[model samples]
Target: MSDEDGAGAGEQLSDDQKQEIAVWFLSNAPAGEIHYVAKDVRALLRDEAVYEAAAAEAYPEYNKAHLVSLELPDRSGDIIITTYGELDKNNYLDPRTAQVATVDHVKQTCTKLRPAADEELPSAYIEEFRNAIDMELSKYVGEAYPKGVCAVYCTSGKDIEEPGADFGLAVVISAARRSPQNFCNGSWRSVWTLEFSYAFQLVEIKGKIQVDAHYFEEGNVQLDTDIDRKDSTLLQTPEDTAVSVTNIIRHQETEYFSSLEESYLNLSDATFKDLRRKLPVTRTLFPWHNTVAFTLTRDLANELGIGK
Candidate 1:
C-alpha cells in the first residue's frame, strides 16, 4: 500500500472488519480481485498475518509498505525463463522494478506456465537479478541486508540447492542509499557486501575464463560455480597453465586507464574552476591533472612547449 493510503490503524482490523475490508476491496475491484477472492483474502485480513506470509514488512513503519507475494517460476522443463515481479504492482514508484514491467490486474494467479523437466538441465545456471533491502535483517522483520535499504534490486545467482520444487534462493538486495545515479546505472560501485574494491571472480559457465567487470558494485552477485578453479591443479607448472596471468593483467590495465582518464578530467575541471576564482586565466587547463604526472596529448605537447 502507499504511504498515503490513509488506512488509519485503529488497533488492528478485527475479524468482522477484515471480512468487511475484503468485501469492500472485492466490490470495488471486482475485475481484479476475482482471482484472489478464492485465496489470500483470509490471510490478508490482519496486517500481522499479511506481513508473516509475504516477508515484506521488514521496513520501518514510516515507509508504510505492505507484503507482496511474488510467484517466480518453478522452471519445470523447457528453456523458457520464468519471470515475475519481485513486487510488480506496488502502490508506490514503478512497483514493477525489472527489465519486463507489465501487469494485468484481471487475475492474481499465474497467467502462463512452461516446462523445464524433459530437456536436460544443467546442474545449475546463473540467474542475474537485483533488489534493495535493509541493512539489518531481524527476526521480527522480514529479510533485509546488512546496510541501509537500497532502492535497486539485482538477483544475479541462484544455486538451486535441490532438484525439485525445493530449490534454495540466494537473493541480493542493493541496499546502498544516498548514492550517485551512476552507481545504479548498471555499473559497479564499491559496496561493503563486495568487500570494498578487492579483486573478484565473475566465473560464468560459458566454458572459459573470459572476464570483463569494471567496478564490483554493492549488489552485484555471481553464481560462483568457481568453474575456472574447479579443474585446476592449483600448483601446475607454466606449461600446463592454459590460463595465463598476463591476460588478467591486461584486463586490469584497460580498466585502470579508463578510470585514470576520468580522474584526470575531474581534476582538470576542478583546477580551472578554482583558479578562475583567484586569478586571470590564459587557459582553462585545470591543475588537477598536475597532481599526478600529467600524460600530455601529442597536440597539447606542442601548445605547452613540450616536445617543441
Candidate 2:
C-alpha cells in the first residue's frame, strides 16, 4: 500500500496532488484566518433552541439563535478566529526532526490525518437540530440540515499594533478577544472541522460605500457583560453579536476613516431593533468590528458615476 490514503481512502497520493491540496488550504481555508464566514453560521440562527448547549461553545456571551443564518450561507467556514487561553507565547516552532521537505510532503501528511473531501454540513443535520429547538423556529425557517458551520476564535498573543492585520479573521477576531483579566480570556470553545454556506437577500455592497460612525451617545454601545460573564452556560448568555457588530463598524470607520468618513447611512432606533432581531444573521448590518467601510464592487461602483 502507498503512503497517501487517509482513514478510508485508496493508495498513497502523488507529490503533485499533495502540494495542490496544501495550496488549496492556503488559498481558501488558511488556518487561523477568517474568510467567508457565512457558511457555518446558519444553524445557530436556524435553531435557537439548541442555544444552551451551543452557547457554551459557539457563543458564550449570548444564546437563542435568530436570523443570523440568512447572511451565513453566503460567506461562512471554519475560521480560526482565536485560540484557547493556552496560547503559544513562544514564537519558537517545535524542533524540526527532519531537513527541508517539499510542500507536497506536508500535504500528504494532512491528507492522511484528515480526509480532504470536506463539504458543508448537510440540510439533514440542520433539520435534525431544528426539530430539537424549543422555540420551534418552524414558522420562520424550520427546514433541515444547515449548509455549513463556521467557528471564529481570536488567538491570545499577537502584534495588534496595526488597526486590523493578523493571521486569522483579521481585525474582527483580534478585537473580539476580551482582556485576559476579564476571565475566559475573551475566547470561546468551538467545533474544529465545521464550515457553512448561505444566500442572503438585501445584499448591498456599494463599491464606494463608506461610513464613519459615532457612538450612540447614550452609551447604549457599551456592552453589558455582567450577565454573560456570570453564566457558565453559553446558550444562557447573550451572544456578543450586537456589540461585535457595532465594534466592527467602528473599527472600519476608524481604520478607513478617510474613505468611509461620510459613506454610511444611519439606521433609526427601530430599524436597529429590526436588525438586532436577526442576531448574528448576515441580514443584520452587524456594525462589523471597527468601521463600516466596504467599497462597492467595481460593477456597483460604476452606478454612482451614472447618477452623478
* Strongest candidate by lDDT: 1
Q: Deviation in angstroms for 12 in model 2?
A: 13
**CA-lDDT, candidates in order:** 0.26, 0.22
Residue-by-residue lDDT tens digits, candidate 2, 1-308: 33443523555545444444333433332111212221233232344333223322332111101101111111222112122211122111100110111111111111111111112111222322212221222111112112221222222213232222212111111112222122111111112111111222111111111111112222312211111101111111112322332233333323433332133323233334354444555656555333322322221122211111
Per-residue C-alpha lDDT of model 1 across residues 139-216, encoded as one tens digit per residue: 101222222122221222234333222211121222112222422111111111111011222212111211112122
How good is model 1 by TM-score? 0.19
Q: What TM-score does structure 2 among the candidates reach?
A: 0.17
Error in Å for residue 90 of model 2: 16
